[model samples]
Target: MAEWINVKDIADGAKFYAGAAIRIMPTPCGLEEGNFIPENGLVYLISDNASDKSYFNCVCLSAGEEGNVICRLERKGNYVLGSEIKRMFESELQEAFISKSIEIAVI
Candidate 1:
């Protein structure tokens, strides 16, 4: 099984925009280590399990602090209808992370 971290745990300076596609990364070493990698087509949702595949369309209710990020994962499809996942970091969906940063270019 893969180790998971909570968004609230490391959501101090994280940035999240609703309706915008975000990504999530997995912590191979666990939350204590605070290490993560970039994951494609995956977003952190409100859950304890880091490997939860169901909470894919979770939306961020708040923004994060500034500095080194722990993980990075991206939301795959279009969020036209909005995110299915809801809840706060300390409550329901606590397990979430941003593995890495991806650069987007405007065409």
Candidate 2:
């Protein structure tokens, strides 16, 4: 199995991106979220560097109270989701890059 590093170990220059929200269509089976990217458009996740991920042209969530739950884009200095990890690092070196945790820096 591949080694998974904690969110903290991610590099500072690492790039992270998110997928766009797609309107769900009601069907007999169930509603399905569209693919990460639409046809003839940029893919949500790009494995080019496989180390630093980049997110662009996507609707970023904001800090707002819609109801009881608050859903927003990742802010700086917070742990990122597993989906934000673009590359895997050596297990031994993970600790050196991070101490407590890491976050998604949107720029």
Local distance difference test, candidate 2: 0.28
Candidate 2 residue runs with Cα over 4 Å from true position: 1-3, 19-71, 74-107
RMSD (CA, angstroms), candidate 2: 15.5
Off by over 4 Å in 1: 1-6, 9-18, 30-104
Worst window of 10 by summed lDDT in candidate 2: 89-98
TM-score between model 2 and native: 0.19
On residues 1-107, what C-alpha lDDT tens digit does candidate 2 reach at each position?
A: 11233444456555443332211112322223333222222111111222233322222222231122112324233333333332331222122121222233568
List clash counts for every candidate, in order.
Answer: 20, 2
Q: Candidate 2's error at 86, in angstroms?
A: 15
> How many steric clashes does model 1 contain?
20
